[model samples]
Target: MSHTLLNESNADQYRTRVTLLGTAGGPPWWDGSDRTGISTVISVNDDHYIVDLGEGWGPQFRKSNLGPVGFQKGLDNVRAVFVTHHHSDHIVDLPNLLLLAWHNGSDGLKSPIQIYGPGNRGELPPIFAPENREQLPEVFNPDSPTPGLTESAAKLMEAYALDINDRMRDNAKQDLRDVFEFHDIELPGTTGDRPNEDPTPEMEPFEVYRDENVRVTAILVDHRPIFPAFAFRFETADGSVVVSGDTGVCENIVKISADADMLLHECIDMDWVDTLMGPNSPKPDANLMQHMLAAHTSIEQVGPQAQAARVKSLVLTHLVPGNTPAEKWQQAAAGYDGDFYVGEDLMQFGIGAPRG
Candidate 1:
């Protein structure tokens, strides 16, 4: 396979900070259940860019001290959103995110946001199938078990709309027709729209966003058959961090994460999941969750990725079974001999200790 991952410079002219909202695939109810999906917010100064608003956003985002105007002003400060791929566990809250931003644009969420990702236009509604299948090459891989890049966000939303609507109760009244603007930012070579149908988009690999403090780079990784899966590397003046969305033993990821100060990767504690789910459990089904395991990375793989990249620390996110009730984060440290952090809802990590 052609690899595009590379070493990155975490250096910057200004400082940047990243925050974790919901870090598990299943929820993480405060009382202790599992349904909240993965969501993270990166803030450069007061400007915050919310990424992958999984399930628990309603409650988690509420944790922000920034009230209605806080959300709206923050939304106004956003630069753009870079999505890893389209998984309900990863982005189901996006529609709600837009709805809230639009509905509250005047007070809470500054509307007309711009989002970039692999699916059709901005996150596609799950069920979308173009009349011509060839148009979307990033999302469809017949050889893999999952839909990959081409999974229609529109279609997926349709599949889960009922469940979502039920939770929204009566408030699910609005139709979010034009909440946010969308840009398809795949790596070079993926879009046939360019000569010769390459797998990656043709845009500049690394970007200095509107804030300009942090540099972002997109790299293709192997979450195969899920066509068009990705990993992003973020660099700030203080340090660098790499986010591995979902993948299994991908060499390209090693390249993208190379030398970053920290790496946050999605992990499946295979041993834990196996022991917990057992043969009688109702999951790992032909349904959405089961399909994810085949292509996802396991904990066994994360340490090595960190070691190879020589990152200062390794953090784990988007965890399945979320290592609940079991010192999973500490256990992960056994794999590598460096600092490791496990993400939780509303968990905050900064460059250094909070001021005294």
Candidate 2:
């Protein structure tokens, strides 16, 4: 569909509309007008909330035509950003989004853009320490010592300090420091522990953020070894929309999405993936396959879960084989009875109503 076709008629209805910014899983690799990284914009009334700012999201957002002409003015419409996890594919565009949005201010942005996500994992013991007797310290070292989202954002800001200073001094003349408010989603007894090994203790869904227009609640999903990955549900006066950031077939998402107006869930076609990593090809390492199967939801799992959730409509996104033929997706949805769509970049859905 043409970007120009996404008119503001639904926005005028005072209902929520979700636009698929990018639907490709993993990274941007396909050749023929294929999907970008996974990103989705959920607009409630006039306020816009972004879920997962994957790679290429900036260009995709512009293509959606939801913002104004100028760069800053266009991004100024985004009220908050919710990240499901810290995976590079899911958050690669964060720095770009933060810089551009801050540079382009809008009258509506009275406060910094709120960013919510999981806290960091516990630091691994130093190499050569007693804990390293059984394992090679250098090989098992932690990715970084950062404790959580708050520190991660601070570090990102620190990395761009010089550029930020230069821009404020010579161009925008605004302190970019005031442009973002970061929050780490923490659960009891989870701090200072390895996320995958010490998952958040099972708890009921809880509010992550709220404003005049919408309320977002989060449920911990089983993306094992990644630790504390989440699926969020946004509720407004018009309807509720749920986003399954990335996960295996977890009941948490099903519970959170129960009776939701729309469910946007991630899906993988493992068979297709295996074909890509062909039989003659060296098999993926056992550990890698374990992580892939444990972390991602298969296509067969989607329909049954959505059926169990009783969602009014289902949109499958973050596709594993992003270039899979449309007919294959139909087969994937064989058990789902309600409205179903194989999402595409720039495809828009109006909540509380049918897919547009």
Candidate 3:
């Protein structure tokens, strides 16, 4: 059945929108690529909410017209951030984001903004390194001395807050404590296809935080060492969309995202890489590509995954080398039965209603 789009009768539509701001490995540093690493901007009315702050992301945030003001309000509604993990590509840009958001001339947020992620939950795993161990403190809970990821996360928050507070004071901006909040989501299963992508990982299932009209669910999936990679199932008033962050072939995704309207998943070309590596005299560069080949989900993995989920459309992202030409992208994704498109940065998809 087709779901109805959610309408905020009290507010307006242009109030919020979702933009795929950055779609690269890390924010463009020297390559001059338009994409930034793994970033998504979800705007509600005029305010924007950002996901993941990869390296060099500051420039792109300004470029996307997400600078400060929203379409209606002088300052964007964007006051909150969600970080899925601590991977360099996923969070290296965070400090800059905090600095940018608190820029005096902008919103001048009165309270610390909320930053929700998995790492905010339990104690850091004993396996974490010393430098990162402090950053990944366990969440604070006097009731439970149980050293967990959250405890590690708490230590990190305290340290981060101390530093950030100093900067805010220097900038003469509002105290970050009044402006920054950290939330943690604990994903249950461990020690399987999923490992600690990092003590501070990215992601929240579709279910956790959403309006009545929207429901999100998270499922365990395989991204090999990128362990604990997620499959986000977004159910709206009208339809459902599944975003498989970055993963290899896995069964949990199929069960979680059954019957989605669209499945936007990352894609890599293992066949071509294999061909390159298999040749008698392989290029030295092919070795690295070969490793990336292992964890990332392959094109061959799509058809079956989508079919199993019964998705209506498929959008392939995180493209590997051969996706240059439209035909190549289409051809690469040809295995799937549904309508498919090659995704690019800033491409928009209207989810709720059809406008005249």
The candidate that wins on TM-score is 2
Q: For candidate 2, list the clashing residue pairs, or say none.
A: 72-104, 120-148
User: What number of clashing residue pairs does each candidate have, in the order they appear?
Assistant: 34, 2, 52
Write candidate 3's Cα lDDT for 1-356 as tens digits. 22122333321333334456666542235243455466776554345556666655566666556555453222234565655444566667666655555553354664455665544323333342345345656555656533333354455557578667777677576665565666655565552212444422333334545643345566655554443345566565556666676666666667666777777777766655665554543653454555555556666667777777787777766555423444655664555687666666765454544432
**What tens-digit string does per-residue lDDT give for candidate 2 at 130-244?**
5525855453325665356788778888998888888788875557767788999866543425554545445677888999989999988877656568899999866888999
In model 3, how large is the Cα lDDT of residue 189? 51
Tens digits of per-residue lDDT for model 1, 200-238:
333433552444656777776656444466777776655
> What are the C-alpha RMSDs, in order, of all predicted structures?
9.7, 4.7, 7.7
Task: Estimate every model's Cα lDDT from 0 to 1.
Answer: 0.58, 0.77, 0.55
Q: Among these predicted structures, which one has the highest lDDT?
A: 2
Ten-residue region with minimum lDDT total, candidate 2: 1-10
Who is ahead in TM-score, 2 or 3? 2
Residue 300 in candidate 2, Cα distance off native in Å: 1.1
Over 4 Å off, model 3: 1-17, 26-33, 43-49, 66-76, 110-112, 120-167, 189-206, 211-213, 275-294, 321-326
